[model samples]
Target: MSETHTSPVVLDVWCELQCPDCHQALEDIRALRARYGDRLEIRLRHFPLEKHKHSYAAAQAAEEAAEQGKGWGYAEAVLARTADLASHGEKVLLEVARELGLDAEEIDTALIDGRHTLTVDADHAEGKAIGVTGTPTYVIGDERLDGGQGQEGLRERVEEIADRLLAQG
Candidate 1:
């Protein structure tokens, strides 16, 4: 029987909000998706590190943005504003939300309510269970990748692996 390519290959990504590696990798992943289109399904999973004090809160903030239909946009904005975040504090999250047309007050309320903490915590625990150790870890089935691969590198790598996975049935 021949294999039918009916669905995208699941690309599980574990990342922290404040990790530079994660920020860079997110762009690469974006490129990967743009190039591959429906061939890949990249799921961003939170893995907030211990060192970045605001990483956990950033995760929740991103989730709150997700509730507002701008999760990735808010995340990308936050990542783009990483430098500002250090000086401006977590309020940078709400600023980014507003920049993305999301309501800062709603995000603030979500943060206060801890609306997405469990989701972030669950992702963190799942990442740890799967042997993820750092930000920007990409798991495609049993294969995993670390480091911040540039845009072309990541798209090419993911394209090659996704093709192989799809071909295998």
Candidate 2:
């Protein structure tokens, strides 16, 4: 993979902020990145479920945080505290953004104004177009690994694919 392609292998991760499965998958992805370094490129794509009332808002908050270079941190905070998102969703998101040194009021206003709705909607549409059925779906090479929640098999599976991609170079 190193010599085959000049770019890093893409790990298209379609996830939602309020999904527990997505949170677990994010942890797994962090571990993978730590182990592999820059050899892999993980792209976070929003796929908020319609069932989760605050999920779409959370996605916008994440993007708003991204503008301040805290996208991943905000996402981690939201995913970790998904329970509180029901009643105090926006408040919690702003708190998380502030905790990450981002401007809470800016993010809150973005959420109120729906600044990142198009980005989130486009990702959702793309995910649906590609037959995504749930959160934590991984699109790597020709393989699509879905339903990675609570499964011990994901790590080895991802390792196998990542190694093969790297070997191809």
Candidate 3:
């Protein structure tokens, strides 16, 4: 009998773009992407901490980037420059949008119009409901790995969960 195809197992990664730890967690995300390829769907969920002044705007910008078909690219660029974001605020977000050849004006309008606020807010609310108190939290199936505690074995844990879920399919 032919095996039925199943949807890829989703790995929800709660992240704050201006978070240094989230930037560090990028390595693990890349590794997972490399390892699972299309078998795993790595989703970036916004969880802008209250401490990061520009995090909320950055999250909105990321949503706009997603609309422009450059979501991950924009996110990686912004995360790579967390320091700049901290120092320069929303300027860094616009800069990254322009650098990625995205519509900077549209992003600016989205920010001002608060178009993506609901999406970011919903993600934040859902994260809080799921016990996400920090950035880079990974949620696969019933497992929740907090990368803030230290990424020591976080990737492996996520891999184990993802592998098991894939096998169950």
The parts of candidate 3 lying over 4 Å away from their true place are 1-3
User: Candidate 1 local accuracy as lDDT?
Assistant: 0.80
Query: Which ten-residue region of model 3 has the weakest summed lDDT?
Result: 142-151
In TM-score terms, which candidate is top?
3
lDDT of 1 by residue, 49-166 (tens): 8888888989999898888888777887888877777677788888788778889998899889998989999999898888888878888868777653433365567667888987
TM-score-superior candidate, 2 or 3: 3
If scored against the real structure, what TM-score would every candidate get?
A: 0.89, 0.92, 0.98
Ranked candidates, highest TM-score first: 3, 2, 1
Worst 10 residues of 1 by lDDT: 146-155
- Tell how far residue 44 is off in model 1, in angstroms: 1.1
Better of 2 and 3 by lDDT: 3
lDDT of 2 by residue, 1-169 (tens): 4554456888888888888888777678889889887888888889999888899999999998888887777888888888888777668888888778889999989988888999999999999999887988888888888864454787678889989988886
Clashes of 2: 5
How many residue pairs clash in model 1? 0
lDDT of 2: 0.84
Q: Which portions of model 2 miss their true places by more than 4 Å? A: 1-5, 148-150
Pairs that collide, model 3: none
